[model samples]
Target: MKKERSFHVYAIITIICWSLAFVLSRLVMQELSSEALGFLRYLIASLVLICLIPLLKLRKVESKDLGLIVLTGATGFFLYMIAFNKGVKEVNAATSSVIVATVPMITALLSRFVYKEKITTKQWIATGVSFLGVMIITIVNKGFTISNGLNWLFLAAILLAAYNLLQKKLVQKYSAIQSTMMSIFAGTIMLAIFLPRTINEVQGISMQIIILVLIMGIFSSAIAYVSWTKAFEVAENVASVSNYMYVTPLLTTVLGLVIAKEFPEVSTIVGGIIILAGLILFNSDQLFSKKVRIKRIGNAELATAAQVIRESFATVANDFDLTLDNCPTNGAFTQAKHLKIDLDKGQQLFGVYLGKKMIGFFELVYHDGYQATLEKVAVVPSERGNQYGEFILDKARKIAAEDRIEQIDIGIIKENRRLKKWYQKNGYEIVCSKQFDHLPFEVLYLQLDLKDEVTNE
Candidate 1:
């Protein structure tokens, strides 16, 4: 616990340095072009990292991982620096920080497609909220128009998100320092195109700007990455460390006022609030929410349950191209009337509630004294990734066990390998598969023995 707390401090230190960079970069850019500023800043960072290599005893990059390292350098430093420097010059430090704060959400969104990570429905809403914040900041000044600076900043956010994904892969095989050092080295090499201009700019640079650039390079670029990586290593998960980024905008705004004497515009404050709201909501499951409860939903609540099922299953239907005409019996097409019929026929319906809101639903059918079936197990599309499905399924298993059922059977679309794996992880085994002529896809049947003591209680 002490180690985790220390890592949290490291993460905060990194964020503080990053917040300072937003303000200091603006100051340095006053006298330097974006290209020169990026080149000079990273050049100093690369030299600092090189000097630490021997002290840190960093390992050499493997030949196979060289491509990935270079890509990280290109995206994280080379491209991101250019865009960020230009954007910072055009926008206030507060606005720049708020725009860049969307990196975590963007990274999460990318991970959904790249690594098959699950995002809850709340997170989807949060992503939309953050983007809406960005849109407001972009158009607040010039009604319905976006500035070139905002465009560059948005691109920078995307490039950084790509860098995060690449870096995450590299860190698995290499130390954080080694991964960061190599990427910085590669990025500095790419920025070498501005070497002549950087040298020319340095000759006439003011001492104040020089000191600011040095601070940004040594503290923000080199030390910040090192500390950020260390925090990730010691923290329980990536989200724990990454959540610290939510405060970047607020910290940058305060730093800008104190250090750079640049107060944020009204739009920046408003937009930053919205962006932070979304970020808070995105992480609310970890921060604000209480434990979920599984309850036996009654007939009076069948209509709401039906809506939850339809919304949840609609995503599956859309994914597999199953329409009402082609797959009318699908849960996406379910109505309250159907649920009533099921209830009258002795089927049990349950809802997974987070406080008063129902986020998931499932039905259980007892086939006999020793057998049962699980059906329509659905979690609201936006409410996924919280393990609500697992919660509901566990409850179903317990209910079956209490009723002395020997086994529980379930069916899923054969093409949904992710779902299949999820069930398998929960002690379900494939017993058989069937191709129904009426349905467009093959169905795989899985069964779970209630006697297995490993069932999640």
Candidate 2:
């Protein structure tokens, strides 16, 4: 369904809500113990979630996927929350958030080994720099020992990383909001086993603390997940969405300074810079090589093209809120679907090859009897900025002209400023904007109206 809410707003909401958890948990800690705090957080969240299930009309998980769902719930909530609460008891919220910032770098590396996802050299370098940033914050005021809650936070981080990966995978089949609700519910059950120890703490809680805990559960747990879940729907890669989380720590640190009055050490600031620098370098495409050969590829080439597209967009899965498998070229069911585009229907499947390797792939869809929609335009990470993107656009224009089509259109994320500007530079202008389902943002429909230009030829 099309959302009236902006995904970017939701993304920021999730971050701010989550960052507040680090501080809110601290407030609750004055009265409730760590385990009790964690339990109440989920319990309250579960209540709010239960109410939403009916309102949202969420789908129920299949019996077959029950086990995976439960495990993900455990990782996301039970283990992660308990450890996080315990760790936050020992450290300030800002420091805790900084340690948590290591999630993106860790998730990428873990995916490489576990899912066999390939990481580029630049990614590895970025990971190292980010890791160094994490180390500076964790080891500065206190040594690397468990005394300052580094061990507990470390454990919480590992579990959080696992939770995010599990959520990403599950969102492929399930709705993000529903799946998140289920995971929270599942984790609440696990935490229920320890309820007896903390059950007494609930009644004794002060009204101020009670109000804060409810806020955490309702906003951070229930609402923040809307963005988290919608991410997989919007982005082709998880990294694209998760990259925004880098700000969580920065925000938390600022909140800490202003609200909690916790002054950060110099090492903390330096580490934050290192982390930002690494992420910046990772996102930069320095390749000036635009020497791409555009051609129609055979079915034998689909798998290679698919892999290139997957690798090219793997970061989007991590950085963005969207799921990786949702891409037609990478999805389980659609990999073959694109390979079988009906040429007779005037649908052209094209590959952007650089020296025998298929670095980018796109489809010119001449369907619905209107414009040839240019779909799935992607350039491999290392080969971007080589004019492959423009090459695809030019090819689409040629095909549109040959087919006597009046328009060639492409849909791009409204938030992708650089790409949107690039498309404008190449003669495409936004004709319309509409909400796309599952995606958190609006898709701008841009077209090169070639009627007059083609007639001149």
Q: By TM-score, who's the top model here?
A: 1
Query: Would you give me the overall lDDT of model 1?
Result: 0.85
Q: What is the lDDT of residue 133 in candidate 2?
A: 82
Candidates in order have lDDT scores of: 0.85, 0.72
Cα misplacement distance, residue 146 of candidate 2 (Å): 4.8
Kindly list the per-residue Cα lDDT of model 1 for residues 1-457, writing each as its tens digit: 6865678888999999999999988888889999998998899898888887656645455688888988999999999999999888898899999989888788989989998888999999998897788777878877998888888998999999999899877754455667788889999999999999888888878899989888988999988988987886555445567778887888998999998899888888888899889988887867656546677888888999999999999989999999999999999999999999998897899987877988888989888567889999989888777667766766787578667777899999999998998898676889999999999999999998765322223
lDDT winner: 1
- State how far residue 299 of model 2 sits from its true place (Å): 25
Measured by TM-score, how close is model 2 to the native structure? 0.63
lDDT of 2 by residue, 1-457 (tens): 4432345666787898888888888778899988887787788888877776545544455798788789988998999888888898888887788777777666767877886667789888887887788777667766874454768888888998888777766754455676787888899999887799788888767899989888887887777776676654443233445567778978998877776677877876887778777765654442223234677877777777667666665655555455634433232223544555644455677787765768888877786665678876778777764456766676667567667787888887777787787788676777988985656667788887666434333
